[model samples]
Target: MRLADKVILVTGSCTGIGKAIARRCVQEGARVVLHGLETEWGEAVREELGADKSVLVIADLQDEATPALLVRTALDTFGRLDAVVNNAAWVASSNIHTTTPAFFRQMLEVNTLSAFFLIQEALPHLKERRGAVLNIGSVNAWCGEPDLLAYSVSKGALMTLTRNLGDALFREEGVRVNQINPGWVLTEKEIQRKQEHGMPVNWYELLPPEYAPSRRILDPAEIAAAAIYWLADESGPVSGQVVELEQYPVIGRNPPKK
Candidate 1:
């Protein structure tokens, strides 16, 4: 058990990558604090993981007070904290001309500002424990996807935050900070996006014969595996780095030729 006896908090964990990370943490002998806005799904995850091993903290990360409340809840229930995975995000697909100001503000508030506040609130506890912080971001942070303007921008800021904080805390506190960038994942929302774009249900089946990149879209467990590695003692020396999760084109490589 790489994370034995650790206490981990994962935000937006009722589904998708967050839920997967929480499950992996529990499997590694860690007590998990699950945070999310989804009440029914959060409770269901709590039950699925066993009530004794996991507890749900209902929070709307978009709110100003949520970060402090999350830290307090974790400490109140778990006695100490070992790690935090800032995995919650908001996505609104819009080009610059098409995006409303409110939409842009809300996207930043959810994706970037919330992370800033959470890190501020979690700092003292993380400093005390010499814990790890993993910020979930999109690979588009570097690749520059024009269609996902606001989301890409927010994730780009997240990448910068990870590097800057990792440098700031490494020498004095021994805390590690890192980012995980997941590629096109097969989540429910992604499926909806494909449908909206007029792709068939079996889109993968329709790929051209020459498209030789991995046939599988990223799985939640695969992302969770990377999360576990980042949180584990093995990654203590690795900070200020963005580790990507997917099959091909690992980090800096371009997409497969069309």
Candidate 2:
């Protein structure tokens, strides 16, 4: 049991990567606080994980109060907090012309600011246990596609946040922080997203070699598997690091030969 007796909070956990992480955490012997915006999805996950081991928080991350509420729920329910996996984000497509100031602000509020506040709220408890923070970032943080300008900027800032706090907290307060930047992953929403773009139901079955060298995108479970190491004590004395979970190099790699 890598995370035996620990309590973890995972945002956006009613689905996708966050849900997978929460499930894995429970399987590894930890109780978890699951946060998301959908009531039905949240309840479904809570039911799946069982009320004995998991509780769901259904709220919008754009709300400033949500962070503190999440922390309070974890402590009030589980008695202590041991880890936080910030996995929620408002992912939308927009470039300069379409990105209004209000739009950009909302992006930051949901994707960047919420993570920061959640971490801040969880800090004191993490210090007591010398616990960890695992931020789920995206490979798009390193200069995303043209359509993802605001989202890229938000995640880029989050990467810096992870590094800065990862160092400061670990050195000053003994709370380790790290990040995982995952590439394209196949999640329920992604399937719907691709369908909205006119891809067929079986589109994921045959991905191009360029985007998926293994002929497929990643699985949330794969990302969840890697998450346990950072959250678990096995990663000892390390912080301020970001790992890119992609099949091949995201930077400086030549395009696949046509």
Top candidate, metric TM-score = 2
Off by over 4 Å in 2: none
TM-score of each prediction = 0.93, 0.98
lDDT of 1 by residue, 1-258 (tens): 999989998999998899999999999999999998889999999999997788899989987888888888888888898899999997658786877888888888899889988988998999999999999998878855677898888899999999999888777788899999998777656677787889999885565533326656777888998899899998757898997775666456665565
Which runs of model 1 end up more than 4 angstroms from their true locations? 204-212, 250-258
CA lDDT of each candidate?
Answer: 0.86, 0.95
Give the TM-score (vs. native) of candidate 1: 0.93
In candidate 1, which residue pairs clash? none
Give the top-scoring candidate (lDDT). Answer: 2
Q: Candidate 1 overall Cα lDDT vs. reference? A: 0.86
Report the lDDT of model 1 for residue 150.
86
